[model samples]
Target: MPEPATEEGNRILSLWQGSWLAALIVGVLVWGLLIWAIVAYRRKEGDGMPEQTRYNVPLEILYTVAPLLMILALFYFTQRDQTILTKVDDSSSHSVNVVGWRWSWAFNYEEEGVYDVGTPGEPPVLWLPVDEKVTFELTSPDVIHSFWIPAFLMKMDVVPGRNNKFAVTPNTEGVFMGKCAELCGVDHSRMLFDVKVVTRAEFDAHIADLKERGQIGKLDSGRSEVAGVS
Candidate 1:
C-alpha cells in the first residue's frame, strides 16, 4: 500500500490494519480449535464406542452466535468508516470538476475559474491546497472511467450522464499520481494524471498561471470546445 497522503487515507489505513488484526485473531482461534479437536478426540485402541451425545446446546449456540457477532462488528466498523469517507458537506474550501474523457482527464478549478486539460501524451496536473478540504465532482463524457489516487486511498467511478463526488483533505505536500482505474477505450492505459499538493499560496499561483495561459473558463464536458485540449 502507498503511504497515505490525506487524513481520510490515514483513517482508511487504520481501518484496514484493524480489520487484518481481527482476521488474524479469528484465524488463530479457528486453527487452534481444529488442531485441539483432532488431537483430543482421536480414537483410542482400547476404547469401544464412545458415549454419543445427540447435541451440545451451549456449543451449538456459541458457534452460531459467535460468528453472527463477529459479522455484525465487522459490518459496524466498515459502515462507520465508509460513511466518514463518503460524507460531503459545505465545509470544502475548493471544489474541482473532474471530467474524464476517452483517453485523458480535465480539471476545472471551479473556485478559481480556470481549467487544465490533458491529452494522451501529456497528462494534466491537479493542483490541490494542502490541509484544505477539496470536493471533487466526477463526470465522464464517454464510457465509464474511475478517478483514482492510490496515495489518497480513494477512488470514485465517473459515469456518463451521472455525477459522483467525494471530499478529501490532503495533509501532506508533495506530488502524487492519479489515473483512470477503469478500462475505457483504446488509450485507457494512457488515461493518467498527477496530483500536486502545495501550500495555499502556491496553489493560488498555479491557478493564476493557468489564467495567464488563457485557460480561464471551465472546460467541463458539458461545454462545447473544451479549451486547452489538443
Candidate 2:
C-alpha cells in the first residue's frame, strides 16, 4: 500500500494491518488443528473400523460460537473505525467541491471562490493545506464515478444526483496521484488527477492565482460549464 499522508489514512492503515494479523492467527490455528486431526485419527493396519460417532454437539457448538465471536469482534472494530472516518463535523477550515465527470475532475475551492478543472489531455491538480482539515463534497454530473486517492486510503463514489462528503487533514506536504477507481466510460483510464499538499501560505497563494486568472465561481454541472472533454 502507498504511504498514508493523512492522520485518518494512518488510522485506516492500522485497521487493515490489524485485520490481516487476525486473519493469519485464525488461519494458523485452523490449519494446525486440521493437521493434528488427520495424523491422530489415521487408520492403523489392524484397525477394523474407526469409532463411528453420529455427532459431537460440544464440538459443533464450539465451532459455531467461535466463528460468531470472531465476526462480532471484527465488526466492532470495523464499525468504530468507519464511524470515525466518515464523521463530518463543521470544524473544517476549508471546503472543496469535487466534481467528477465523464473523464476528468473539477475542483471548486468554495472558500476561495475559484475552481480548477482538468481535461483528458491535462489532469487537474488539487491543492490542500497541510495539517488543516478540508471537507470535500463529491458529486458527478453524468455517470457514476469514484474519487480515489490511494495515499489518503479512502475512496467515495460520486453518484449522479447524490452528493457524498468527507473530510481529511493532510499531515504531509507533497504531491500524490489520484484517479477514478470506477470504470466510468471509454476514457476511464484518462480519468486521473494530482494532489498537492502544501503549506497554508502556498495554498492561499494558489487560490489567489486562480482568482487572478479569472477562474472565479464554482465550476459544476449545475452552476457553471465543466471544462473538460465530455
Candidate 3:
C-alpha cells in the first residue's frame, strides 16, 4: 500500500502501527504464560489435591494496575493523535469548500472564487501545493457522505446540516486516489476523485487553467441548512 502523503497522516500511521505492535507483544506474552501455566500445573493421575491458596494480593494488584496503566496509555495516545488530526489551522495557505452531493463532489476554492464539480464518470481533481497546509470545509447538500483520501489516511463525514473541516499539509508531490467512504446513495460507488499535489507554481497554473475554463464561480446548492451538528 502507498504510504501516507501528509505529515498528519504519517503521524497517525505511526501511532496505529505502534499500537498494533504493542498489542501483539502483549498478546504473545500473555498467551505464552497461559500455555506455560497449563502445562506446568497439569495434574498426573496419581497426584493428590494441589496446595490451596487464597488471594495473592500482589498478583491481583499487578493484573489490575497493569491493565489500568495500559488502558490509560492507549487513551492518551489516541486522544493526542485525534487532536492533532482534527486541529484546524485557520492560517492555512489554501482553503477549499467541499460539497458532497448525491454521487459526486464539488471542490470550491473559496479564496480564488473557483469551483470544480465532478460527474459520475468524470471525477473532479483537487489541486494543492506540496508542503503547504490546505484547509477543507466539507458539507453535503442532501444526505451524508464522506471525503476520504487513501494516501492521506484522512476521512471526514460531509453532513447536510453542518460543516466539518480539517487541514492537511501534503508532504509528497503526486496524484492520489480519493473517494467517498460512506454509502450515501445508489451511485455512491462511483463517487471518486483525484488529488494532485504539486509545486506552488504548478498549483497556481492549475488554478489559472480553471479560471480560463470559466469554472470561476461560487457554488450554490440552494438547500436549506438542517441545523444538525457535524
Candidate 4:
C-alpha cells in the first residue's frame, strides 16, 4: 500500500510498523521456546515423574519483568506519537471547518469563505495546498460522525457540541479519497468525499472558481451554534 501523504500520517504509520515488528520478534521467541519445551519434555515410558521442580526465581522474574518492560516501551512510543500528532499550533496557513450531517459532509474554507456541500450521490471535494499546514475544525450539526482521510491516516470524531481540531501538512500533491468512517444513519455508507492537494496557485484558483460559482459564504443556519454535548 502507498505510504501516507502527510508528514503526521507518516509518523503515525512509522510508529505502527515499529510496534508490529517488535510484536513479531516477541512472538517468534515465545513460540520457539514453547515448542522446544513441549518436544524436549515429552514423556518417555521409562521417565516417570522426572524431578518435580517448583520455583525458579530467576526465570520467573525474567518472564514477568521482560513483558512489563516491553509493554511500557510500546506505551511510551504510542503516547509520544499521539502527542506529536494532536498538538495543534497557531501556525497553520489555512483553516477548514468541517460539518458532518446525517448523510453527507460540508466543508467551509474559513479564510476564503468558500464552502462545498456533499450530497448522497455527488460527494464534496476538499481542496488543500500541498506542503502547507492546514487546520481542520470538525463539528457535527446532527448525529455523530467521523471525518476520515485514509491517505492522511487520521480520523477524528465529529461530535455535536465540541470543537475538535487537528492539523496536517500534505506533502504529496494528488487527489485522495475520503469518507465518513462512522455510521450515522441510513446514508452513512454513501457519505463519501474527495481531497485534492495541489500547489498554492492551484488552491487559490480553486477558491476563485468557487467564488465564481457563488459557493462563497458562511455555513447555513443552526450550524454555527454548537449543540449539547453527547
Best-matching candidate per TM-score: 2
Question: What TM-score would you give candidate 1 relative to the actual structure?
Answer: 0.89
lDDT of each: 0.90, 0.91, 0.87, 0.87
C-alpha lDDT (0 to 100) for residue 135 of candidate 3: 95
lDDT tens digits, residue span 1-230, model 2: 78899989988998899999999999999999999999998888998977789999999999999999999999999999999999999989989999998779999998889999888788999999999999999988889999999999999999999989999999999999999999998999999999999999999899999989998988776223843533
- Give candidate 1's error at residue 21 in angstroms: 0.8
Residue 102 lDDT, candidate 3, scale 0-100: 74
Better of 2 and 3 by TM-score: 2
Give the 10-residue window scoring lowest on summed lDDT in candidate 1: 221-230
Which pairs of residues clash in candidate 4, taking residues 3 or more apart in a chain or in different chains? none
How would you encode candidate 4's per-residue C-alpha lDDT over 119-206 as one tens digit per residue?
7788889999999999999987788899999999999999998899999999999999999898898889988999999999999999
What digit string (tens of lDDT, one per residue) describes model 3 on residues 7-59? 88878888889899989989999999999999998988999998999999999
TM-score order, best first, reads: 2, 4, 1, 3
Measured with C-alpha atoms, the lDDT of residue 211 in candidate 4 is 97
Instruction: Give the residue spans of candidate 2 off by over 4 A.
Output: 222-230
The model with the greater lDDT, 1 or 3, is 1
| Model 3 ranges with Cα > 4 A deviation | 49-55, 220-230
- Per-model TM-score versus the true fold: 0.89, 0.95, 0.89, 0.91
Candidate 4 ranges with C-alpha deviation above 4 Å: 220-230
Every model's Cα RMSD, please? 2.6, 2.0, 4.2, 3.5
Between prediction 3 and prediction 4, the one with superior TM-score is: 4
